[model samples]
Target: MPYIEECIQSILAQSFQNWRLLILDNRSTDSTDSLCSKYLADRRIEYITNATDIGMIPNFNQCLDLCDTKYYAILSHDDMYADARAVEDSLTLLENDPELCAVYSHLNWIDGNSQTIARKKFKTMGKVASDTIAKTSIRTCRNLFGVPLLVRAAAVKGHKYESAFYFTADIDFSIAIGQGLYHYVIDRPCYAIRFHASNTSMRDFSKTRSELNSIADKHRIKLSVVDSIRMRINDWQTRAGKHLFYLYLDHFRKFMPACQQR
Candidate 1:
């Protein structure tokens, strides 16, 4: 709930004023309703509180169903747009190239307090091949594309986030979208993803890893011996990277009296 205001504010601050903001509350018990009520004055912002607590993936599907626009982007409650131009930049890409199914930008990792922990960037920009997106994601065992991703409604007309993949559905969705249509990439980091104790992936690391493997298998194409070895090595490296990230957070907290006192 503490982060909700900032998340809404980020949308309100977008350089592109034509977009609508949908705030979906999945029957949260906190002061989420009250907090979101403050933003109801804006006609563009719609707040919908579910009558019953639907699971996360269902909530995402609900949002997709509710979308009536040509292009839509889903912003997580804990995350925010990195800059005001995020919307404009993303929208421009889709507008210019009708062929692009979606356009995603790099993202920054931020702590609960919204302090930047790291920046995740990609060397490539512009139209990326569908096969390349799948191969790169598989090679790294990570989703190369991050959020503030603007997706075309027509491109994903019949698609929905697969409920079976609780953790890696985003990866699945990404690969699914790129099957025929191309996905573009923006060079700049346009989103900030929050890392906290409650993060789903962080909380269930092993399960998430298992799901990643399942996704890899489901989307498997013929791979060379070298590509196969790289996949295994990258998977291990991703696990180690997560451990190091948490260790760094712990060390940071130890030195900060404010964090220790809390």
Candidate 2:
């Protein structure tokens, strides 16, 4: 519930007020649904609760089914936008360039205490074309999660997140939607990733690993030998950094005991 509150306030604070939120409840045992239900008086949101726990992938598919707009953004429970200008910027890019299916900005990692820990930044070439990303697809073997991006719902017309991938479903979805000519990076910081004890990073490390391997296996044809080597390096750095971050932080150390020390 607290997670949902943080996300909603970020959206409501957006300089752009013309968006609707669709929350697809996945049979959470917690009071997640209750928190959203209380906010039903607000007409801008449309909430739907599923009878069974559809897992994350199916829940995302259901969310897509409920979308009635031209563009769509996925707001994960534990993450929020960093400021009021994010949506306005996203809308501007997406509407102006028909070739771009999505645009993303920098990501800021915040602690459970809401203190800044790190910022993930990207170098942007002036008026970068999504074609470069598409051309490099075969040479790019690693997957970058979330990445402060927004997607065009219309572009997702024939796509859906596969339920079988309980861990790396977002990776598969990104590969499919980015489609070589559509995903671009914005120049400013836009997304906030909150790290704490209750987050998914610590909850299913082993399963996540297996799922990541499965994703690479399924896309072997798209990876060059060089990209594969670079990907392995990037993968180790990402996971290792997460584990170390949680372990070093006095309060966060308890949140990731499930992670086997490497």
Best by TM-score: 1
| Candidate 1: clashing pairs of residues | none
What is the TM-score of each predicted model, taking all chains together? 0.91, 0.81
Instruction: Highest lDDT: give the candidate number.
Output: 1
What local lDDT score does residue 109 receive in model 2, on the 0 to 100 scale? 83
List RMSD in Å for every model shown: 2.9, 5.2
- Clash count list over all predictions: 0, 1
TM-score of 1: 0.91
Q: RMSD in angstroms, candidate 1?
A: 2.9
Model 1, residue 150: distance off in Å is 1.2
Query: Candidate 2 lDDT (Cα, whole model)?
Result: 0.69
Q: What TM-score does prediction 2 earn? A: 0.81
Residue 252 displacement in candidate 2 (angstroms)? 7.1
